[model samples]
Target: MRSVSIKELLTGKQLLQEITVNGWVRTFRSNRFIALNDGSTLHNIQCVVDFEKFDDAILKHVNTGAALKITGTLVESQGKGQSVEIQVRDIFVHGGADPEVYPIQPKKHSLEFLREKAHLRVRTNTFSAVMRVRSALAFAIHQYFRDNGFYYFHAPIITGSDAEGAGEMFRVTTLDEKNPPLKEDGTVDFKEDFFGKETNLTVSGQLEAEAYAMALGKVYTFGPTFRAENSNTSRHLAEFWMIEPEMAFYDLDANMDLAEDFIKYVIRYVLDHCEEDLKFLETRLLDEEKTKPQAERSEMALIEKLKFITDNNFKRVTYTEAIEILRNSSPNKKKKFQYLIDEWGADLQSEHERYLVEKHFKCPVILFDYPAKIKAFYMRLNEDGKTVRAMDILFPGIGEIVGGSQREERLDVLKQKMAALDIPEEELWWYLDLRKFGTAVHSGFGLGFERLVLFATGMGNIRDVIPFPRTPQNAEF
Candidate 1:
């Protein structure tokens, strides 16, 4: 006799032998067949019980969602879709769920309904598969970084300087809210605060990661970052994870190559390692697509889409070139796009991005040399004076999958740019010191972890991929 997981038991290694297993009853239909699952696999093990031998009291407890310990003899199953079954010798009820109250029935539930039951949604097949895929993708990301000689560098969650932009961070304060300290200027006195200055949850770890990358040669950050943007969209989250890798000597072109290789590696990893879960998701996505009109459905299946990205080379185009392509494209000329690309400096919307990646290029597109005013101050300014060496990677459905640039290494140019933006020098004096001492060409990009997950899993909403999503209006979990 041995205790084994349902996954291992189904391998037929314990066939004709007595074994012990622990799991929750997914369904106890007819009181003769108990669908047992331990979260070890998407498939459940069928436990055939002799209802005549067990008392009704014990059988009554074997409801769906009830945790059970079963001692049974593994034998060949005569049922379809299953190879083996358990002949229960004994049963123990560890916990029980009242059928009336248990929300996760063996039926289809809307994604909106599942969000309300976040704690128990993992018991369902779809969420369990989603979570399993999420875990695999996370492991794949770290594996890719480690294999590429990138060290994991952790940045502080509470930071004094805003990396992306100001006014988009959640304030971190321990001071009194009703009657707080005020200065003569009638402003809240952060000088007496816990950190003795203004602090907020970090919106990006790029700045801190750059400091470490300068020393580590290559460094990456994978952690929770907070953004206070009040966007209630499927693509935005109040709290999300970011994957940013900063390289010490890499230029913009090298940065683009790394981004492409890194994403393709992770996606390939998921395709191989999470095949079972991905197949399930692929079928789920196909079903979801069927509800839409023929014109609105996806061009390829879920798994096919993943392979398409890995097999194809990303089309590299300049920002000005992309603008000209979009400006003269049929969509723009016919007024099909919501935001028409009228000029070079115009910000491209999702419609324009999809057109370039999906319709025009038919592959991932890396658009570089963006307008300097639209990009961050840290991005390297091109010789053209009007544009910076900023690049954005756009996938077919996902407009912006990655954003990176060769950083401004020139101390004088960086100061001029900062001064032009009214950013005080003292706010980032240490950052300036890197250039003063021994700064060289360095570049990095940030990949929104949830967005990657959403794409890999063929999920529509950003919240569905994350376990407990933190949105502008919801954080109940």
Candidate 2:
């Protein structure tokens, strides 16, 4: 007989018919009822067994985490929780898991505990729902770009130059670690390396995407990015995914509009397609918040918050205005902030960003016109000569969901900025050539894929959203 997933059997396609199902047993209750899930959806199908007919030895193998194949007839469930169940006529144990040794028992486990068991964490309800939503969001991103007439550009994972100039890169080398070839200057020689020059995992695909966008007219890159920063915060990940979209003839305002629309579209997509997963996560969040203090709980329900974002426009503020608001705020006056906002050029910390988005504005906020020195060299310099046309979209829970800016198309200004920052001109000759030939006002932004999952699923840690989180001192899985 052809096997059907438990998800399909529960959706009411047909009833009172014999069928075969394959899945892992979530729980074996009363030795007669089985909860099975195959990762197709959040809900599980209940399977009832007639213990009097089956031998006790065969029934003992039906434990949590055990894989099973059951041939049964679907009928209306007599139980209260589920609408339908399977009456098993025959059962085969594909894989048996000992209850005493199985790590994923039928009980609540802490997120920290689950992190150690990253390989098997998805079997749990919380992690499974998160991954489902993550998958939906990824598909939505591609669909949005394709529907908007943007080509999906595949940027190289290995590159010779750091696009951000952040100086925290994981070098890719094939040289011997113990005895590397050294030059006359006492530095390791990279000429004999695989690429014949120093190369590393790409930190961002923005530069390469820009090249494609200039020719293709509109392009977007969705791929993995690496950063060797050792800071192990809840927000930082050693390896993560980035979504960068580059558009020709786009100004700062247009860039902001696209980002806002792109984000809401993805969220709405998940709401439409992953309703079951979202509902389970909402219940999980509500239950989790009961353990926290009353003041720390969320102001609105998870679904309500998502609806509010899609229904309203993000608040727009300038860097100067945000500075004024932060400097005069009660937290700054009372010395409550860890990093106080003292002047105009100071970079905004997470606390300051959250204040503007959650407390002051009470909605999503887009802050633009950052100081030139604080921003990257590629951002367009403003008329004031001190500020650049950079914008950061801050969400209520996530500090900076998207960061973007208009590129400096003027060849002289770009070269001067690069020279002032001591960036090697020879390495980026091709990039500079774009500005020299037909460069006409391009802009793009990068959205951290994990941050989006964190907001959508209401997961607390950034590591929880990703399957195998790469962090400092913790790359086991």
Candidate 3:
């Protein structure tokens, strides 16, 4: 009477039962057999329909990629290959798709070719599994925060200042581009704009989330952020989601605890809830080196890792120690890095981060107290005078999955740092007022949501995990 999903049916041992299924035909073999998928999982259910029982007109309309509603009696497959098969009795064609026009067919298609038809890419098994895993991870994030007694704050998408203090931001406005407002000195008059000043898409929600945390004690913001940088790398995205959690009266150790626990919670949740999808990924989607047998790579392994992180302690190392390790490493000589790591002041690149996490620690590593010059001005300055209170969480596959820091609570120190960095004083007046009135020690971190999804799904590129990814030189679908 009711429709059943292929995913649910595959897990059960019942056979020779009546069932109804509705989905687009993935592939058709001869005139009597068809493969149907409802985008629930990678595996499609095979339906055997007798051509002689159906009208010739109905047979002609039942083409590959056409939407169908079929009522059938499920029977255990006599052959040793499949577990079960459906013997169709009635077929209803909801929509017909021409075989010559459908982008996806039974044959395999390259990831590059699929990217071109991103709107229709979800129909594929790999993309479908990826989307399901991505959804599960997002739910896990919310569940973790809610269960941990953290208030979810919706940070503004358009802001007056870059939270990261990085100069990469997309302008958001209704002002005419052609006849723009100009000042006496030929500078664009931002006063005439919508916000009465230069406004851009927020790069991070940590700063705003801190405002709420200071009042509410703990808060997190999960929303889409924009970056207008032209770097065309597998890691960078023009538009991506950021998960920022800010906590008041929290030190560096407490912040690290939240980071480690949150990450583990998300990974464990996805693996537990999306078991079928994870099995598909492990066997089919991931690279051969990373793939493992479903039984060997038990969901408990993921759960155990998460429990270990939550119960045990994490490995913590200072920036100075990280640089020392990099300087003495052999990869430094072989690989030509974008930024050289000769001394303690150099910014750590992806290669250095990866080396520290994968080769040196062999686990998730938290590197803190970065040099002041390389980090944001808002970070609390350490007693060393050369380094600031910043932390980056690096994983085995993805380099820097999370970036966060303790805020500069002192008004005087913040003002001095802003002056030295040539940041506009008026723009940060509201932020400064927060410190002047009553500012407690606050800390927060920004987790790249897509990067986390990439780590969870074992998807190599950042684009593959996100639906309709917006990257430099590419914005298909």
Candidate 4:
């Protein structure tokens, strides 16, 4: 007999064949049937054991959370939920999880309790399904880029320059903590540090990706990005994954088109491949929403929300138009908006983005032409002078799912912008060199990988979607 995966044995065409399988026991009922799962599928295989034939010692060891290797003949199940099961011929205990001490019992536990047990949470159905969908989404991302003529570029995790221009970063150093090098001005001298200068975890891979995009025509970086922002909200993470794709010779319009198409394609891929997992998450979300107020409940279920992305075209609206809509809308007029939009040039918040997507547009909305002062220094200056060619794709719950802009390729203009922002030219000399040598119309966007996984899994907390969440005062796992 050959060892077979539970996933295959559940759906495969090998009936009545004796097979060997290794898995953890999910549940043992009536001292005769064993629920076995090998992390291969969400569903468990019911191994019907002949209690009379089995030794009492072996039967006593078959308990929930125990790791077992079983030789069984695959046969059609008489159970309602599953189509197939295993008729156990033999059982061997590889490991045994004590029922009294094993934390993960076969029951519905709160996400909070599960998060505390992050190390062993995957044994649960919810997290396993989420992780499975996450894996599929990641694979789909690479596949999409590869099929679209994009090269994968790995950006350095430790960077000398702050790409986001936000000073928050986890300083990387190998200097003495109490007494080491000190500048004459009473500041810690970074000049004598490991890198011979100050360095921190990268906030983004876009700048490096831009360099490769100028040469390779299209490139993408999917890696962990760090931020030291002290946010304890459900959406914030100190460390998270980012998918930033840069394309040379692509204007803002083309960038938006690519983003919409790419998001839809990946979502559709997951919907097609992870039907069982997605269905479970959908039911989970429905149960979760049942406790919330009617007004606050989700208008669509989990899979319905995923289908919403693939079935409908994203609505494109300018920042100016979005501002006008928000200003005239009931939320602003009734003073319901926490941050009122009374004037132009005000940075739009999550509420504003959601209003436009969920309330105003009732679909995904692409908002473009943001004010220059509110955007980054690299975005191309529009002809109107007050705006840059920046665009943000907003989803129903996620305020900004994607942010991109046509980069300012003009060497003189880029230098002027850098000078105004007080960003040292030497710090990014290589970046400036791109503009000098072969700069072209290029654009890219950074999509938080956790955010995508969260949205796809209908998960409310960003921490739950990511395997090991790095947050303020929390890095236990």
Compare candidates 2 and 4 on TM-score and give the better one.
4
Per-residue accuracy of model 4 over 1-477 as CA lDDT, tens digit each: 667889998885889888999999999999888999988889898899989999998887788889999998889988887788889888999988889888999998899999999998898999999999999999999999999999999999999999989899999999999997998989999999999999999999999999999989999999999999999999999999999999999999999999999999999999999999999999989989899999888888888888889999999999999888999999999999999999988999999998998888899999999999998988999889889999999988778888889989998988988999999899999999999897789999989999999999999999999888999999997
Quantify all predictions' global Cα lDDT against the true fold. Answer: 0.92, 0.93, 0.83, 0.92
lDDT of 2 by residue, 236-288 (tens): 89999999999999999999999999999999999899889999999999999
TM-score of each: 0.98, 0.98, 0.92, 0.98
Candidate 4: segments with Cα more than 4 A from true spot? none
lDDT of 4: 0.92
Name model 2 segments beyond 4 Å from true: none
Q: Candidate 1, after superposition: displacement of residue 107 in Å?
A: 1.0
- Considering only N, C-alpha and C atoms within 3 Å, which residue pairs clash in candidate 2? none
Superposition error at 53 for model 1 (Å)? 2.0
Report the C-alpha displacement of residue 474, candidate 3, in angstroms: 2.6
How many residue pairs clash per model? 0, 0, 0, 0
Is candidate 2 or 3 superior in TM-score? 2
TM-score, candidate 4, is 0.98
Give the candidates in order of lDDT, highest first: 2, 4, 1, 3
- Residue-level error in angstroms, candidate 4, position 318: 1.0
How displaced is residue 173 in candidate 3, in Å? 1.8
Candidate 1 worst ten-residue window by lDDT:
1-10
Report lDDT (Cα) of residue 354, candidate 1: 83
